[model samples]
Target: DMTQAASTGGMMEMPRASRGQAHLKLAEFAAKQLRGETRVASFSLNGWDTHSRQKRNLGAALERLSGCILALKQGVGPAVWDKTAVVAMTEFGRTVRENGTGGTDHGTGGTMVLAGGAIRGGRVYGRWPGLEEATLYNRRDLMPTGDVREVCAWIMRGITGTGISDLETKVFPGMQMAQDPGFLR
Candidate 1:
């Protein structure tokens, strides 16, 4: 996809390729199986490395991301959309400090976004770690107090009826499941 094309074009043509192709491909695959209820779908679009021209790269990434979401919504029918859920995330985030070339370097603490009618929409979850001295990780990156494993546990229990004990003992050893508050509608 976009990454492939962008790479072939030496980085300038990445955003030129359509990001919505992934969603369309998924719909095609689902249709072949005659599936009635598709529960989940995940996708990732890269090119966030803004070593130069940060604004342009960010804009293109946002546009492509938006297109992908819209296409996915249209591909999946309304009935399924009402029950389905989409969760997007990145491995990590970049540093707060802009580099000399108006770019960002690898850092800690990325963001996760959830979308769909099943989600409570119009609400941002998670605690915001204020950007300040003594708050950064190793005095350079954002501190991650929230363990992602706990979030995964909640989703497994609530969505698929996985037992908390099993998740704690098997999936993530020694993880204490806390109150997830039913993120799904």
Candidate 2:
């Protein structure tokens, strides 16, 4: 139905011609999982390495990401949206300050965006380490205030009804998930 829906005059234009089709594919895959055809799915968005003119370069990436989110939500429909949880995360972050080349270097501390009817929206649940030069990691990167695994463990524990002990010990070995920043509703 997406091809037919796309034929409507009111549909949004593709942020980037090449990548837009992939967003549609993401929506299709999500629909399959919602219909009990799959248990899980994942997708990747490219072009985060902005080594020059970050304002311009990063916009395209963000737009494509947004496009994917919109397509997924629309494809799933409101009936299934209430049960979904879309977690968008980056493996790592970039430097706090722009580098000499008008871009950022790879560093620690990125973001994880959790969306859908299941998430507790409008709240940024993380310890904020201010932008003071001394507060930065190695004087270049934002200090990582929250453990990524803790968030992961929290989500898994909620979904599986698993105990904290198993989640911390078995699910994530050697990692003790202390703080539970509840992102799930």
Candidate 3:
């Protein structure tokens, strides 16, 4: 089964390094989904802890993430890809200003990336808080304009057909999913 999945998922063509291997494994799972062998798959890529020289560090991390996404799409094919939703998130945000080491410290607001054909692709969703000193949270971090939990709740509602009440009470307690952001297609 591993051999069949590897061949079908193009795992042999992937790199042998650990990071690349994670992507290759995700692709294998995606291919299994295509064959009705799985319904959900998830993988994690590390190296986001850029405490110094963030430009170089973050760029490399993004590149790896990009490769992973591309591999998943290719493994699933267009038809299945259209039904998939890829959500990439981090636990914390970075400061708006660069640190002495040219990196950023943890801050109040961060970003979430949603991909695949299932999402409404073109536009950025969330209100932008200007970077002006008056606008920044504590004059250091981007002011969070919306609750991330609400956005996530909406995405879950759309994907799982779960009722808003259940999403509010069960999934994310005290989260008032104000309006449907219409993240799904």
Q: State which candidate has the highest lDDT.
A: 3
Output the better candidate (1/3) by TM-score: 3
lDDT of each: 0.64, 0.72, 0.77
Error in Å for residue 99 of model 2: 1.6
Total clashing pairs for each candidate: 1, 0, 0
Task: Report the error of model 1 at residue 75, Å.
Answer: 1.1
- On TM-score, the stronger of 2 and 3 is 3
Worst 10 residues of 1 by lDDT: 4-13
Pairing residues by index, what is the TM-score of model 1? 0.75
* Segments of candidate 1 deviating more than 4 angstroms: 1-38
For model 3, the local distance difference test gives 0.77
Q: For model 2, what is the error of residue 79's alpha carbon versus the real structure, in angstroms, after optimal superposition?
A: 2.9
Candidate 3, 9-120: lDDT as tens digits: 5332322446346655656555655546554555567878877899999998898788778888888889888887888888788899889999999898888899988999
Compose the digit string of candidate 1's lDDT tens values, residues 79-119.
66676556666677777777888877888876776776667
Question: All candidates: CA RMSD in angstroms?
Answer: 7.5, 7.4, 5.2
